[model samples]
Target: MLRYIAFTVFLLVTGAAGADRLETSAGSVAVTQVVGGLDTPWAIGLLPGGAFLVSERDGNLLYVADGTVNRVKGAPKVSAAGQGGLLDVTVARDFTRSREIFLTFSKKQKGGAGTAVAVVRLSENGKRLTNLRVIFEVTPGGSGGRHFGSRVVEALDGTLFVTIGDRGDRPAAQDLQNHMGTVIRINRDGTIPGDNPFVRDQAARPEIWSYGHRNPQGAGLDSQGRLWVSEHGARGGDEVNLVHAGANYGWPVISYGTHYSGQKIGEGTSKPGMEQPEHYWDPSIAPSGLLVYSGKLWPQWKGDLFVGSLKFNYIARLAGTPLREVEQIKGPETERVRDIVEAADGSIWFISVGQGAVYRMTPDT
Candidate 1:
């Protein structure tokens, strides 16, 4: 049976609660609210000089600083329909010097059929995207508007890790050659990484890094240099994965969730060669954006993994252990969380996917 999720209203209306100690297998500490009241904010990017950039799914880019916000100019026009819009925005790794930004979005294509992923550079002056480009794109064959799983991350090696959705095609998830249902790795200049798994394969897109994902909306790097991804399963199998080169995640083939009619998904939960998730949620937390926090403000949370939820509307603090829940934080907008990032001052910032709100969580002053 299909489940229904309710969205919380604008986040600015909420008040901060006193800090409380957290308990986790990895470790935990106090959590305090810093600021709130954002409008369907979808993603956050921390600038070098203690400034912040926030994206609203409805196509507005916001600049938040000191205790206020200002709208940026020239946001790309987007579809903003069912699960589509000005999606993700991120600061370039060299932002301290270059003052450039990169992001992904689902914009309307020529036909009413598909959506394309655009990666544009945000000017430092917050005026317009100077060097706009569609670095990599997916097949725009949307049937009923679901699953673009588009999240962008700059790898330590200067490669871009991009997550693509299964495009509402179940069986295609197992197809080795398609761009859908795969994590793609590309150079910052939009070229396929030479060392990618499919780079030399004539049958596969050279950019394909890993395969068999439903919609991995969240990705981040931990202290150990491991790349972690959070994804939504068919109905119940929300997963957290440690990404490995050339691994297949086994989406439609095996899942913690059953079919719409309560039938089996595929062969089974475990199969040969397919890499299983490091952790998964059976009841479906609808995990969205992910961040491995390293800020000093929350020294207790330094090196811990923080994930946002769409259905649960909480920022879940998970233990580094294989598969177990550690802490669930419900203070943000209580809406579908779209992205989370560490601020310049070591604070944690996040955005709401529907209400277009941005929030900050910091240690007790």
Candidate 2:
């Protein structure tokens, strides 16, 4: 049954794109393609000036404004191999004054590559990045082209939260001496936060906020200012977790999933000390970007969470305290939805990686 579902999703994601309408529980949605000709676009950051900063997995930074997309220069050299490459991009809250932006990418090093975060100043005309400097990087880089989890989210208090993967090394998730498989919290200037969980632990990385995560690709704050993350599981067990400081989310130590070879994993699912997921999926949907809905545009959807499903090729709308998947949104043009965001006007925007386009989802009249 899971294989059948996956096959169906594969067809949908690979189908030709032309349809402009999608039927949803709330109402009909008009799907408009904003721009195309992108190469494996990874994430989108909305600018205060009503533009967009888009990053491609091939290490290109693009500025999209008024239907025109231009490649921005001065991006750091990245290992554009497999899952490694330029990933998420975010603009500062005070962009008007600071013109600062944050970017996450897979940084190449001697042995292999690791997730890295940097801050740069966007030029006035959006042509290039200035003052570019890496703010945070995962240490003890290992080999392999998979699991360079890089997602950046800024807290309301102005701290930056970066999600990193285990770098295909399951045991490393339990290690505190390195930055692998951890959520790192740092100040805007790349300094460790004094209040960070491991700040006083001389043996641990001070930037570590939480530990034992595997490929956390999506991160955002809820309406109440709480951090939430969506992470990928091994064969199954895709999870939505409410992140907290000093907490440990069991990865290889305890997983609701099995090895790719279909063997049991880690002393069964539940453990005494490991934190449990708010929600999990048995047949993983390969969740990527996540956003808690405000219902500003869709009144009924307020407070719900929207997730981009790479495995299923749809948008999963989840609600309730312990989150549950309530709906899967599908349209003819819908491709592998990579990232999701709510526009200032309340409309939702998402990137379709399979189609190489950005799409707007608005209410159909």
Candidate 3:
């Protein structure tokens, strides 16, 4: 059994299962395995009663508590193929009383598939969900299974924001008529937010908050409640952008990276109307999860941004207005870090896809 040391001191113990003790500029850090035997867990939501809700890519929502993983029933049927399947899960702030959970998944449509969102009520015992319903779904589902930019975040005012990819159709990102390659906003019941960017634009999807995003997977609200996202670019040019309503992020039009065929993208990374990324990675770490650290155990890390590196296998520590990678935390437990979350207690939790386990990071003692 792994022992829990007091948080006030610094001590490193090794040889524990799923625990990797490392030293960093902040101080000693320890990552311990909380639960394992998951099948490609994509995202996690913190539950009120000390349990975690984890979504697996194979179309299963798992309830993990007391070191045991239980499969949650009543999730929407998903198209679990090629970067699709069950994705992000977010719990409502008043979860204890509301029992409402939001989910984003790759839903199969008539001839193709698209990213879809659903709202469901988790049972009191945490066994299943009832009253399942789709709150939002991307329009004009297209063929192929790539680039489902599915991530869900609840804004401070309880509005919902979801990301949808271009579905391998690069040019579609620039089109506002369909839901592809856009960030959309809606009410809790899936109604279009009146303040959404394109709500008045009859030619555009009214739910679109912003457009021209490529395969965005990581999204989170900062300490100030500002929404930010990390998206993947071709060959290179991964980006982190501060999302704004009515904004147009240059995707295919102005990219720092070349196409997979080594062709130049757009008119070269600069245009009058397109918004620039807050930070970008040239070689592409393939960012997946994002969290703005509200540090509790490590007070020094508060306000810093924590991002997962899927390609390089590490957690990136970014700082500054135009974010820059200051540190990369990687060790035995660092594996295809897929999703990241900061618990109410301020402990850091992440889904390590490489290890098929959910790992927790805390101050060493």
TM-scores for all predictions: 0.86, 0.94, 0.94
lDDT of each residue in 1-365, candidate 3, tens digit only: 12112210111222134457978778888888777666788999998768889898978887866545557889999998889999999998878888999999999998789999999999877889999989889889978989998889999999998989899998899999999889999999999878787888889999999999988999999988899999999989999999999899988899989998998998898899999999999999999999999978788888888899899999999997667999998886778999999998898999899987788888888
What is candidate 2's lDDT per residue for 1-365, written digit by digit as tens?
35334533443453345438889989888887766666798998888758888898988898877545567899988989989999999888888899999999998888999899999999888879999999888888879988777889989999999999999999999899998889999999999888998899989999999999998988888899888889999899998999999898999888888999999988889898899999999998899999988898799999888888888899999998768999999864557888998888888989989888778788887
Ranking by TM-score: 3, 2, 1
State how far residue 227 of model 1 sits from its true place (Å): 1.4
Name the 10 consecutive residues with the lowest summed lDDT in model 1.
1-10
The CA lDDT of each predicted structure is 0.72, 0.86, 0.87
lDDT of 2 at 317: 91
| Model 2 weakest lDDT span, ten residues long | 3-12
Model 3 misplacement above 4 A: 1-18
Ranking of models by lDDT: 3, 2, 1
lDDT value, candidate 3, whole model: 0.87
Residue-level error in angstroms, candidate 2, position 46: 1.0
